[model samples]
Target: MARASSPKRKPSRRPWRRRLILALKILGVIAALGVIALAVTVYTTRAQLPSFDQLKSSPNGQMIRVHAADGTVIVSLGPSYGEWLSYDEIPKVMRDATVSVEDRRFRSHIGIDPIGVLRSVKLMIANWGTDRRIQGASTITQQVARTIFLSNKYTLSRKAHEAILALALERKFSKDQILELYMNKVYYGGGAYGIDAASRKFFGHSAKQLSLGEAAVIAGLVKAPSHYSPTADAEAAIGRAGVVLQLMAETGAITPEQAADTDPKSVALAPEPHQNSVRYFTDWALPQLDMLIDETNAPLDVWTTLDLSMQRAADTAIKADVPKGVQGALVSIDRDGAVRAMVGGKDYVSSIYNRATTAVRQPGSSWKLFVYLAALEAGYKPDDMVVDEPVTIQGWSPRNDSGHFSGAMKIRTALAYSVNTIAAKLGQDVGFHTVADMARRFGITTPIDTTPAMVLGTSEVHLIDMTRAFASVANKGIAVTPYGITKVTANGVTIYQHEVDRSHVLVAPYVAAEMTDLLQTAVATGTGRAAQIGRPVAGKTGTTTSNKDGWFLGFSSGLTTGVWMGRDDAKRVGGLSGGHAPARAWHDYMIKAVAGRPVEQFDTQVTLPEWQLEPDEESYFGQPDNGMFVDENGYPIAPGTYPGDTPTGPPPQQGYPDAYPGGTYPPDGSRTAPPEQPPVQQPPERLDQDWMDRVLGRTPDPDRRAAPAPARTPPPNDRSRGP
Candidate 1:
C-alpha cells in the first residue's frame, strides 16, 4: 500500500484540471474571435444598410384597374389596398401569431439568433443535397433585411450579410417597427402582398380587424404562400393554422385552453373566387399584371380589346335564352380576332367553368364549313351537283335531316338544306384527310378524327376557336390570334403594348369568298335561316345525332359570333338542333352588338379558275386517278354507264367503297339512265315514253298511257344512316 501510494506521483499533476484549463482557453479564444468577427460584420452591414426613413417611400404592391375599350373600368385586380398601414395599424393578435409561427423569440434576437443559426446549420448538414431549409431560422429582422436591405441570395455570404443587416436593423429600430415591416412586406397568397391586401382579400377587412383564427391562418402562409393559402387550399391552411395556434399557446401569447378551443376550420373566408365580369377572362389576364408593373407601385390602367356593350349583350343573351337547367356560351370576335364579347355561362358565380374558350363539345353539322371549303378547293363549284339522295359509304349511309331523299340538287341547294348525304359524298370525294388538314390550317386547334364522321363535326371544339375560324373567313383567309389586352400604362406612360401580328395567313381570298357565298345561302334559305340578321350574314347550323349539343356559327362583315347550348353532363338535349335556340341566340346577339357599326361586306371575290376537265373517255376502270369522267359540257359524270359502252368489270369504288351491298348510280344521281346493256327485252312503249318525259322535265300525263310510278327508294334504316 505504501508503494502504490508513492506511485500516484502527485495525482498525475491533475491531468483533467490541466486539460480543462486548456479547453477553456481555446473556448475563450474562439469566443473572442467570434465577437470581433461579428462586430466587424455588424459595422460593415451598418454602412451598407438602408435608411429607416426610406420606409415611408418603400415600394408597396399596387392595385391595377382593367379598362374596357371605351375606357370604362372592367375590374380592379391585384392588391386592392386603399393605403399602406404603419405597424400600429396591424393588430396584436396578428403580430403575435406571425412572430410565434414565422419566427418565435423574434423580440429577443439581435438581427440573427445563434441558437437559430446552430439549428439551421444542423439541418443543412443533415439534408446534404436538398435545397430544403428544414427549419427557417431567419429572424423577422433577418427577413426584413433580405426584403428591404439585401438580396435574397442563398449563400454563406448572403446569410452573413443578412445577419449583420438584421443586427443593424434591430439597433436602429424597435421590435414593433421591425414587426410592422415584416407584416407589410410578406406575401399572403392570391395576388395579395402585405397584411392590408391579404386581410382585405381573405377576410374582407383590414389587418386590424382579424380574429385569432384568421390571424393564425394568415400567418401560416408566410412559410409557403400559395401552398398554405386559406382561400386556395383550405384543408392544408387550416392544419397549418392549428400548428400556429399551438405555438402561440406554448409561447404564452395565448392560453392553452384558448388554443384548444379555437377551430381553424371556423375561419370566415371571402366569397369563393369571384369577380364583377367574366371570372375566366379576369383570371386569364392576371399574369399580365406582373408583366406590366415592373416594380412600380403607382396605379396602372390595362386597356383591353373587350367591347363592354357587346359583352353585356352576350351575357344577357345567355341568361335570357339558354334553356332551363342547360348551359350556354357565346363568343363574338372581330375580323382581327379581337374578343369583343364573351359569356362563358349564364352565371359565372354559380359555375366558373368557362364553356366559351375552355369546354369542348361536338360541333355537329357546323363542321361542314371546313368540308365545303375542302370541296371548293378541290375544284367543286357552287353549281356542282350534290344529289340530296340517300347514299351509303363504307357501311355508313347518310341522309337528309328529314330522313327523306331530295333528289339531285346543286351544292348550294344541298348546303342550304343541310343534306347529310351530299356532305358525306363530297367529303369522300375530296378525302377526309384533306378536310382535316384544311380545318387545322384555318383555326381549329382541336384534334380531328380522320374518319367520315368528322365531316359531320364529330370532333369536339371550343366556341372561341370555332368562332375564331369563322372570324378568319370574315377576315378574308388571314388567321387572327385572339387577344385581350390592347395597352397597359401608368401615369400616362405605356408599360406594355400588344404586338401586331401579321402572320398565320391560311386561305386564299377566292376560296373564302366561295365559302362565304355558299354559307350565305345556308343562312338565307337553309337550316341557318333562323340566324339571318338584317344585313348579309353567313352561318351554319349544327346538331349532333343524339341532340347532345347544338351550335350556330355565323359571321357578318363586321363581326362573327358563335353560340353553344347544351347540358354540362353530356345528357341529350332532346329535339334541340342548331337552327333552334342557338340560331336565334346568335341572331339576337349579333344584331344588337353590331348596331351602328358600318355594314361591311366580304371582299370582292377574285375570278375563279375554269372547272378542270374530267377523266378521258378512252380511260378504262383503272384509268387516271383524277376522280370521275367529265362530259363534253365540262360537268363531272357520276360513276356508272354511258351510251354504247359496256363496263368491263365493277369500276373500283372511286372515293369510298360502295357502302351498300350493291347500289347503282344513273351517272347523274337519277335512277334512269341511257342504254348500256341490250335494250331490256322489249321496253314497254308507255314505259319508254315515261322515261323520255321524266328526262325531258315533262310530268307524264294520266291521259297518256298510265304507268306505275318508278319504285320509290326506301328510307334508310337507323343502321344505314346511323347516329
Candidate 2:
C-alpha cells in the first residue's frame, strides 16, 4: 500500500511514452519487413514462373480413360473429359455468361479487382469463425493463378502467392490466351474438364455449337460441377441457368428480353444411346482398374469380352417384356464364362444397382438342377419310380403344383413334371448338405443353407452365379469363372493379359448328359415349354411362392443365359409366373441372340442306344431308406423309385411293372408269383414276353417264333411325359 502511494506520484509518464514509441517502432519494422518479403516473393515467382507456351502444351491434361470393346469412347475416368478447345472454338454466349457471373470487371481489371476483394472480405467477416468459402475474392486472372499455380487455401500467404502469380500470368500472356487456357482447363460435370467436354456431354455438340441455353447451363456449372450437372439433376441445372441468364442480362451482356427468352429455354438433351449397355460390363471391371496400371502410368487400351450385339438383344428383350414397375436382369455367359452380354436392369439410368452381379434372390424351382444333380451322384436314375404321395421331413411338407398325386412316377417324369414332393424326397435321400456342395462345385459362390427347404430353392443367389452354374452344364461340367477383361495394352504394347481359366470337371460327362436330357424334357413339355427356340435348348422355369420372383435359366451348346424378373421392393407380382414372362422373354431374346450361328446340338446322344442297357435283377428294388434302386439296365433307378417289387412278394405292386420303359414281361420275372395273386395288371402298351425276348435278341420259342430284335417304340408321349 505504501509503494502504491509513491507509484501514483512518481510512476513516470516517460516510461509509458517510451513503451508506446517502442511498440510503434516494432510495428513499423514489421510493416517494412512484410513489404520487403512480398517484393522478394514477387521477384522470385516472376523469375521462375511457367511460360505461356509451357501451359499451352498441357492445357488439357488428364488421367486414364475407358473405351468400349469396339474402340468407341464410352467414358473418361480421367480428370479431363474431352479434347481441348481454343478460345475461338468456345461460344460467345458461354464466355459472356461466365464473365457476367464469375468476374464482372474482368476486362478492365489489371490482375485483381479491389471492389470484388473488399466484398469477399465483407462476406468472409459475415460468415466469421468458419472456414467455409463464402465467396472467392479472385478475379478471372486470380482464378487462373489458383487453378494452375497456387494451393487452395484461405490464408494470407496463399492469397499473396495467388496475386503474384496472376500478375506474372498477365505479364507473360495476352488476355485472350489466358481466357483460352481457363476455358480449356476448367472442370465441368461428369468428368468433363473443359467447356468443350461440357458442351458435348450436356448438348451432344461441341463448344462452338453451344446454344444460348446450353451455354448458360455450362457457365452455371463452374460454381459446382456435380451440383449443377444437367445429366445428374435437371431441375438444379435449370435453376442455375436462370441465374446465369439474369447475370448476363443485368451486366449488359444481353438484353432483358434475351434474358427472359433464354431463361424460358430448356436444354435439348441427347437421347440415351444404345451403346450404353457397355456400362454394366464396365462397371463390373472397374474394380480391377487400379491393379492393371503399369510403371508408365499411361492409359490402357483394355479389350473386353462383351458382344455389343448380344448386349443390345438382352436390353431390348428386357425392356420389351418387363412391366412398368417391375425390374428384370439378364446375363448371357459363354460356355467359357465370358460374360458376352449383361443387362443389369431395364433402365440403368433409373438405377445402377446391377441386379445381374449384385442382387441376390430366391431361385425357386431353378435350384432343382443342383438337387437333381446331387440325386444322380447319389446313384439315383431317371427311370426309377418314386411315390408321388405327399411326405414330410423336419415338419416340412412340400406339395406338387397339382395337389393330387399322380400315384407313382419315374424320376425323369417327376423332374419333367416339376413334382415338388418327389424332388424334396430325393433331397432327403441325398442329404441337403450334399446338394449345397454340388452348387458350390458348380461355381455358385453365394452361401447355400442346408435344410429341407433348400431343394425348394429357399437359398438366395445372384443371377450371374446361377448363369455360371448353368454354364458349367453347357460346357460339359467344367466350372467357369465369369470374366470380362481379355487384354490390356498401351502404345501397341501388350502389358496385361488374361488367360482362360476353368476349374476341374465337377460333373461327370455321363451325369451331365443325363441332367441335360431331363432339363430338355422341361423345355419340351413342362413349365419351361415356352423357352423352345425351334432348336435343341435345355432350361428350367422357376416361379417363387406367391409369385414374388420369376426366373428362366437356359442354355444352348454355345451360350448359357439366365433371366430374372421381380419388384425391387420385393412385393409380389401376383399372376406373373416364370413360364408366362421369363420363359417367353428368354425364348425371344435367345432366338435373336443365337441367330446367324450354326445350330450345335447337345453333347449327349439323343437316341435310346446310348441309354439302353441289359437289365439285371440285383438293381431291381429300393436300397432300404436310401430311396434309390437299380433298374434292369444296371444303372441306379430313378430318384422317384420305391420298393415296388419285392421279388418274392405278392405280384409286384399293381402299378409297378408298367412303369418300366423297357422290354421285360413280368414285374417279378426273376421270382415266381405267389399262388393267391393274379397275373400282373399291365398297361395296354406293355410288351409281351415273346416280344421282349425278340427285343432282347433272344431266340424265339418253337411254339411262338418271334421276329428279329423287335422295334421297341416307347409311348408316343414319353418325351413329354418322362421315361
The per-model lDDT (C-alpha) reads 0.70, 0.71
Off by over 4 Å in 2: 1-189, 194-275, 293-296, 605-723
- Residue 698, model 2, lDDT: 48
Name the top TM-score candidate. 1
In model 1, the runs with Cα more than 4 Å from the true position are 1-47, 51-57, 82-182, 189-191, 205-266, 270-275, 278-282, 285-298, 387-401, 404-407, 428-431, 602-723
Worst 10 residues of 1 by lDDT: 617-626
Q: On residues 651-680, what C-alpha lDDT tens digit does candidate 2 reach at each position?
A: 234445433222122322232334455556
Q: 126-232, model 1: which lDDT tens digit per residue?
A: 99897775658888888887766555446788887777788877877788888887787766777787888888888888777889999998999988886787765
Each prediction's RMSD over C-alphas, in Å, is: 16.5, 15.6
Residue pairs with colliding backbones in model 1 are 111-166
| All candidates: TM-score | 0.61, 0.55
